[model samples]
Target: MQKTLSTLTNNWAPSSLSQKVFLAQQVREHEAAAAQPCGFSMYMLMQRAGRGVFGHLKATYPYAHNILVLVGVGNNAGDGYVVATLAKSFGWQVTVAALNPHKVLSGDADTAQQAWIAEGGTIRPWQDIDFKNFDVIVDGILGTGLKGQVRKDASELICALNKTDLPVLSIDVPSGLDSDTGVPLGICVHADCTVTLVAKKQGMHTGQGKTYTGKLIYDDLDIALTFNKIAQPSAYLVSYDQLPKLEKRQANAHKGNFGRLLTLGANAGMPGSLRLTSEAALRTGAALVRAYCHTDSRLSISIGRPELMLTSDGLSAQLAWSTCLAIGPGLGTDKWATKLFNETMAHIESEQKTCVIDADGLNLLAESQHAFSTIFSPKHCVITPHPGEAARLLGCDVPDIEQDRLKAAQSLAKHYNAVCVLKGAGSIISNGEQSWICTDGNPGMATAGMGDTLTGIIAALLAQGMSATDAALYGVCLHGAAADIIAQQYGQRGMLASDLFEPLRVLVNPT
Candidate 1:
């Protein structure tokens, strides 16, 4: 269950029927494996699925006076018939683009089709109708059963669909898009909103799926089925606007009220890394921040920023005071870095200090595999690893992790019993038992030291008493929001991580 967040639906997004069927199979598999049976019947499940999808559409396009639903020969067409009939019964102008050329539909699909016709529904094909005349198109053609490239007729239909600027509400995933992959089957509908039933499909998160499935949304469809073997989710998306607000501060609050942030790294020429983290923490409202850097960088760091109590290769002065530690930004992974990382990890673990590890620190962990467990316990740690670092942690290649970020993030979190933020576009955040995908941040954040900024931001929020879950949500959002502001000032290409500090300050406490 989500942590104190509102339901997944904020602005509703509907999905395709293929996705619904996939969820059914998933539920069935869960029942077969988990020993708990879903109390609902299959037909009842289908009914809920149809109604839930319809409900979202009605809510989304409430202003549309006329709704045109395109129905095919499959069960998806049956769903369309259901919606169209409902709309017509409610006295709206409804038309059906019946692509079922032959008079041959079966099962529940045929039953629904006949009922629509009996109630005076009109039908036509692409050749016979001007699709643009409709305000909205309900695509129920060719559901998830479609595996190969779309046929000529379907492609023509899809092309016709593309020609119209009219918004489309797809039932059970978009037509011509693979429910599991989102790649167009040589043709696909560009839906404005997709209504998905039961559970979401894997294809919605990665690759081209995000484009086809505009605004990924979910609906349980009132199918109260017990599931045992929940397929590992493929990816995650951070829900928006449901983030927790900071606790109210008392007028008597002092420096001690905010947590202390400890940052390690900044080897010589790379003072930029340590500075970014320290600056970010302070700017993001950390009460106190201290940076431990190379002797060569100490003078420069101190000169550039008087706020930081910079020390050369000495963390003992700050370690005892820090509530959360951020390590590895600009920390080279050479002999010097290895020694520093090992020493810090050991001290943090032995002293029971809460910590975050990132950049070369993760690389160091990979280098000294056994040292990780020795230095940090599961609960007091968070690791921000990009694909390469994640691969190193798992002893695999980056491609394997990218193939499934959700699994990769989970594995890293579970193995260490630590919060793992898999850095990159659509970042995966997990604490082994639970996980999330960041829905914010743009390409401007691809610049250097961004990860370091995130490390400090997370540390700062944690020090501020946000639980790991809320801390992550707040940190990621704040980090992205800061980056966005910088991007606005310097353009995405010129926005550096350091540029984020001031923006972070504004976002943390605008008042």
Candidate 2:
């Protein structure tokens, strides 16, 4: 007997099952080979996928009697057909709408369609249907096989669907969404819930996919363990649960036992940026945090944070005292900023100290004349860059970086020979060889000073004896997770970067 997805964690996948993300091609190429090992045929897998979608729909919207299943002519359409059949069996009013009623569907998709017909169901043209009558919409149109922009007709249909208030449940990958890059081919179905089958598509968790795929549910159809064994994941999805646990301090441990972190930045008028970075380092367990800023901003930075040791002199001595360094924040592109950034980079390279460079530091690095490989040690450095800064660093347009963020992040890491945290909707951390995407965080974090906070967190972790890769991974997840908590409590709107400090302190000491 095939175990239904309902019996396995209420139609939702366990973290272990959903952690590994694969490209659309990997899933298409290896799904059959993976299924064979479990003695399941392609049709059997299709049937299970349909069953999973139906089970979840029923559970989520029990009162939804009238459903419209929007389908294209592919395996995704087959899944929709299965859902229609199952809904019909359960005495619900199910309507399966096909983009082209005359187009032929071969193989298992055809088999599934025939099965739906056998169940006395009719396939209606999407144009003729009244969407307002349906309680929920099942999107199965143009799954992972979508190659380019959606055709004019399909685009119209997707746009029409988006305009409706009906609750949408997308099958496999969301229709018209690129399952690999998370970019929409043209316009994608804005699903309220996406029940992904086989393996989680890398796209659904990041980029524009996050907006389109609302509440993501993964159902492996009982073959994910087998599928994962066969396919090499392009990247891994990271969350709060996967954070590296900080070791408990010994009873005798003092301030000096943790680490010394020096945060350098805050040009003439940007005291808040430096303050946020230094405070974040303090919250993340850095023993002693020093703020080395310009004399113009010293009073404002030092007055509020009495815990911070503020200094305007002794750059060489501060660099020597610090176990880890976080530079950039408010460091501008002026002569003052340039001199500090150069001295800091030189010190990091010569002293072999771990450092995190963000904001103006990244800008300076991008504008640097020396080869990146020679000036920085890859193992001891981390760079945090938003899409614009990343574009500058890579000498490409923002669209190029956003088009394929995973590739861009890896490129940044490889190019700079350092761990790169590509900050955006889905923050990606990469060390060139391995990559992880943070699934936490919300729109509230889009405010100013967030990047500075991240730099501080990463530097603190590095100071606390974590490797550059581990620090980047842990810091990115931690920063986002903290913002998620803040967003939940105070709402996403009007949230501040300084708001994260309290939660950062709480989360870093996770019990």
Candidate 3:
């Protein structure tokens, strides 16, 4: 059951997430400052921002006969005023549909509003109009300043807009997407394309942000600002440039120089599972990869990849010689599997060894807190669990894991006193302190044996001297990075775990 949850990763992926990070507001601020005028007046910047948005609209909806701008009572609404005025000048029927008619708008927004009205553009209350009648809807209903869930008038309008099927051009993120977590704060606007201004917002890429952003466009309003004053982002969406490069091995090195890897899993029909794990380990550059799984499983295991060694069970003393042990690829929940699981746990408890536990191994551990409560140091342990397995380990639900992935991973690391890899579409690795999100991987790699591949990658990293936490982060980052290459070669829908081996092999050769 724990292993089945690993496959759920297939549906949880977001497309090209790193590009979403470029939508951050911080970058938007930098762009504005580039075209700063002498005095740097706020109104002047707003004017440029309005013009920039109008420019994009012209290019996006050039054939539109009518353009309807939804306005609020803030700076976001002011941008709408600018868009309406620009479109009106081109003979496009423009309307400023004010969501909050009674609220007085001020600052640059107020000025922009009066100018649009003076120029013969009609400003009408939103209550008087239906969204379905609009040719194009410019959503200026919310801004980055919004916090908490949206409700009431704004929520109703967002709902109405979604039903219109109009090509919406959003300004600075889809209204309800969180600037940090990428989760929606209640109801959110669905945009056909979002033209974010000034700085990029974090929410546009991670979590559920991609769906809301649509065809995202960037607009830097040319304002003067200092990045030093703005705090650095707490997290990052991994990109190709951010991935660690793999180096070619030195000519003098041999198979022994890489590091020996030992694994235990595979029972009967599940040999494909352990076989996949071993192959990933070997392909990932493990010096000498070996496995202890069901003997009958060897029919397919040694067919092509003769490098793998098979056995029914492992010698108790063999733990001393192995650099890292990967456990639970397909260790089915049978009586013998339990005995093997206990024996593996015994080795981990008595010796200072590096090991990764997945699948049934995790289930067995969840059966009794006493098994996890053993007095072994947490430094050598890495626990990789999908949502359900994680839920069982933490005594919670799947929603709890998705609600705050950082919190769940960190909490698990702190409780278990080991690195926890919360396996999912934005796989998180944490040691109760420094945590990282792996931006690599695509929907194609979501097929069977994917998590096993990850287990092998991390174990290989550990065998080569990466600490439990570093190995976990590096492994996660590298695994996803490799999957990204596969995704690019084969379309996202058809990418496979085996396709990642070549990229993984290249990434870890040296550097």
Candidate 4:
């Protein structure tokens, strides 16, 4: 009997829902364990993978009458052959295009290829066919085993596949893409959708992998629950939905019930960033949000936001009253900015107060590693840096940081001895030991003042009794979730950083 969709949903739900990400090598080890003495055969596993891919493809593209299956030299090809056989059985025109005519298949892959041949399926050399004739192309060229750039012939074919504008369904990790790092080697297949077998590859959700592996689909092939116990996840993919709701406030509680948060930024011409930060803290439920800007900026900043207790002279008093501090939203690297940055560092290091450092504050840190190491303590600090800021802090190129975001975030956290929030497409939140990726937020959040807003949000969460790590993770998720909601209403284009304020308030309180 053909399995119902319920079987797939029931058996496969936890694979994606679970908070675990296995590296490529870890996935190989898990698969090896699954094929052991008491477990299923590699052939059986391949059969399930092939069937799963075929089922998803058939359902997704019901009108697609012609399928061009790109087969390589490995078990990935074995899966493709099985797909062709199934498609032919369903009376659809199927063509298996061989990318590696010289390679000899072995083990379960050899068995799978023979089954297709026995069923009257003819395999054609890649050079013999034209891609324009097919309705949809199936990419099974390279599996997770690929480490480097694709070979010459495959690169040519991949380039061709990409140019056709046809909907390509990748069987596993897209050809030439690092299944571990998410960096595309030399050239990679840009698939419309990728059906990841076994478990979701760690690379598929991060870095450049997000662009190549569109519409990621995971099929665990009915592995027993014990399969998950084989490896501890390298990291968890987190979202706002998974976080705990904040406790309801007491009716009689006053302003001091929630903690006080102080923001230090807004040099001469840069008042807007700090203003956004202070307001965001208030919007996120800080009992009192204060801003200490340059004496010159106080009048302009105080005009619109009277709720913020803007002060310049009593820096010591404000620092003492504040439970949490957020520095660097608009703090430039000028003389005045440097003095304040130095003072904030001294106070936080001495008191071990929770703090979030972002924007130009990060720049000041990158300017002198010697000065930074001398002044700061990671005990209660959270550093938020975009790729450019991270590159500066690490003394590396932006591409180098982007190529391996997880590593960069972890390295940053360890280097600063604090929680690191590496903000980008898939923001990585790490404290050296453990990490989480916040897969929320939209391209609309690419506006100015967004980072400032995030600084305030995280600082507010910290002021409200969250640990540095929890506040970073929860704040990143909430910030992104709020932006996502605002994007839906305002559209991604022309969306402002301030649009997140109301939605953020609703998210924190959750009425």
TM-score, every prediction: 0.71, 0.95, 0.81, 0.93
> Between 3 and 4, whose TM-score is larger?
4
lDDT of 1: 0.72
Candidate 4 regions with alpha-carbon error over 4 angstroms: 1-17, 35-39, 369-379
What shift in Å separates residue 86 of candidate 4 from its native position after superposition? Answer: 1.6
Instruction: For model 1, state the Cα shift of residue 483 in Å.
Output: 6.1
Candidate-wise lDDT, in order: 0.72, 0.87, 0.73, 0.83
RMSD, each candidate, Å? 7.1, 6.3, 6.7, 6.6
Q: Indicate the worst ten consecutive residues by lDDT in candidate 1.
A: 1-10
> Could you arrange the candidates by TM-score from highest to lowest?
2, 4, 3, 1
Number of backbone collisions per candidate:
16, 0, 15, 0
Model 3, residue 319: what's the lDDT? 62
Best by lDDT, which number?
A: 2
Better of 1 and 3 by lDDT: 3
TM-score for predicted model 2 compared with the true structure: 0.95
- Residue 191 in model 3: shift from native, Å? 3.0
